[model samples]
Target: MSVLDFDNLTKRYGRTTALRELTLSIPEGSVYGLLGPNGSGKTTTLGLALGVLQPSGGTVRWFGAPATAATRRRVGALLETPNFYPYLSARQNLQIAADVKQTDARSLEAALETVGLAQRQREPVSGFSLGMKQRLAIGAALLGRPEVLVLDEPTNGLDPQGIADVRALVQRLAAEGRTVIMASHLLDEIEKVCTHVAVLHQGQLRSAGPVAASLATADRVVLGLAPGTAADVLRAALSSLPFVQDVRPETDGRVSCALAIGHSPASLNQALFAQGLALAHLEMRHRRLEDQFLELIKN
Candidate 1:
């Protein structure tokens, strides 16, 4: 059974529909990234999935059944900015949270260790940096040993080093065999950390798949031919290689083709030379995640 499933989930705040019949399934062991622009319903989906907000229509299931009071304990979430007592120490704050959640001492210890906060557990919250505070919040979410961790914009408002620290911590948590559901506008973070991605635009799903395949939508092997090289000759040469696809002539006398996954641009160039047309230039343009993200939001 999938870790989480949203079945035609829809949400409306009176006249404003936040989500529109969205359906998705998150498998076990996936670091799932929920991606979209500011108002594309990423947060709304998380909220509905966590039962923080009631959906206007549809159902959310956890581990093959509808979410219930018991099901929520299996998932942990850190949405928006976290709050802790300024005067309280990190350990104290977590102890309070643990008391509220009924988490035991062993679980709390494991949680602090997972986020690398055990060394500073006794330090006051006022002494912690933004990244440290974020880690503490994640540590709190780890209470009760939840199987799935849900984080919304977890890296927001941190310095570069802090971002790196949190990123590493997140990677470690996922390595320990926990499914992670994260919502973020940062494509780089998603690309670096997530195994699966679901993109939303205008409250609708634009695409969903493995991160590599999603970003590899149209990776091109750019071939700039020598002057006066006929486009037909290039097309004819490419025809012999079935893996070369979407062959088109550029206005500047360059020809570009989609290289099949696992095939490098060097291999494509070698294939072209073997076909007896060795002329000018060959370059590989690996499509950027941001470029793919923009295209999704644009359409």
Candidate 2:
């Protein structure tokens, strides 16, 4: 069942519209990615969904019904950098947040462990790295053990190690059976961590669905043959297959091709093997999120 639904949701600021007729559903137990470039309505969509901002038109629904304050409580979100006292320890800060949110004080211990900060519970917030700070913010969100987490750029301003840390943590959270809806401009991070993705552009949804299926729906595939084989030999084989379309050559002596809408890497491999050819290297590449985002807005 869908845990969240946006029914023709629209949000506008006077003459400028931030969202346009967004109709999307987020099922339970999904790690959903809300993606777009800056100023592409990603933040606005999250705000509307969580009731932090009112929609200009249409309804926001949670758990198959219209959203309410009680429904909002079932979701935790971090839209921006969390404010923590520089001198206060992690535990101390969360304690204050718990009281402010009126969540159970007993959640303090579980929240700390959920974000993997229990070991450093006594450390001052000032000493933590940017990634640690982000994790602490997520810990604060996790205080109520909400059924869903709405995180806007959870890995912003972090080093590579920090990015990896947060990715693993998100996966862990999903494995625990909670839904996560993350809004991020970092396409690579979203590709790595999210199971489902929705791409937005100019206040409109360009695409939405399972990440792999959406990417594979229409993608570029690169096939490299070993030194003993000529490029023409493989090209001829691929060209004969119905699933391969727009077969072309690459500068690196690889064959670049597009798969038919319903085809996949496995289908290509199976078809090639039937013709007695073993693939030395096969890589599938899709238009980058940046390129796709531009195309969405441009068209």
Candidate 3:
């Protein structure tokens, strides 16, 4: 079942349309990556999902119901840059979060420990570094023991170890059956962590589905070959085959080409063999989510 759904959502600002008829379903217990470049309305979508910003049109649902005060308790969010009272200690800041979320006040200690901030619990927020501050902000979100987590750039501005720590925590949250919605420009991270993905561009959803499913295709295949006299002969033979789009030499003595629909790897191999060239390697490269995002923005 979907934990969150946006049904024909639209948001307008004066003459600008921030979002347009956006629709998506986030499955329960999935790590969903909400991805797009800057000014692509990713942040706006997150705001609307959490009920921090009301939509001008359509509605957002949490567990098949509209976002409400009761729903807020089940959801935890880290939107934009986290802000805390500089004078307050990390422990004190989380205390405020605990008071608001109505969770156990002592859960603050558990939250601090989870984010590796146990020893710095008494340190003032102003004294914390950027990555430390980010961790503390996440600690605040985890204080409520939420069923869903909405985070924007959770690993941004962090060192390598800090990034790894945050990544591990997010993965652990999903393992514990929490639905996590993460927005980031880090495509590699999304590729690694997200089970499902939603690509947004110009405030609209370009694509939304399982990461693996979306990447599955038979559009084209790139083949690497041994550097030899058969390169031209191989190209000539494959070029005559039906559904071959284009063939070009690669920097690594390989031939890159595209295959049309109904063209199988076996057929491609057969064509190459007919020309006296043996296949060194055969790999199909599908359109990446990053490539799809760029295509949407360009259009």
Best by TM-score: 1
- Per residue, candidate 3 scores C-alpha lDDT tens digits across 167-226 of 898999999999999998778888888999888888888888888776554245777666
Q: How well does candidate 3 score on lDDT at residue 276?
A: 71
Q: Which candidate comes out best when scored by lDDT?
A: 2
**Cand. 3 Cα-lDDT:** 0.84
lDDT scores of the candidates, listed in order: 0.86, 0.87, 0.84
Q: CA shift at 81, candidate 2, in angstroms?
A: 2.5
- What TM-score quantifies how close candidate 3 is to the native fold? 0.85
Clash count, predicted structure 3:
0
Against the true structure, candidate 1 has what lDDT? 0.86
Stretches of candidate 2 exceeding 4 Å from the true structure: 84-93, 113-133, 223-240, 249-255, 261-298
**By lDDT, is 1 or 3 better?**
1
List clashing residue pairs in candidate 2: none
Write one digit per residue (lDDT tens) for candidate 1, span 1-299.
57999999999998999899999999898899999989999999999998889999999999998898778877878887677997999999999888867778678788888778899999899988877888888889989978999998988767787688778867887899889999999899999999999999888999888898976865877787788878778878887797888987876777788877788888888888887889588877787888888988895
- For residues 203-288, write the lDDT of model 2, one tens digit per residue: 99998999877666557899988877888989999999987899999966789898888788889999999999899899988766
**Per-prediction TM-score:** 0.88, 0.79, 0.85
Sort order, TM-score high to low: 1, 3, 2
Error of 1 at 106 (Å): 3.6
- Model 3 lDDT-worst window of ten: 213-222
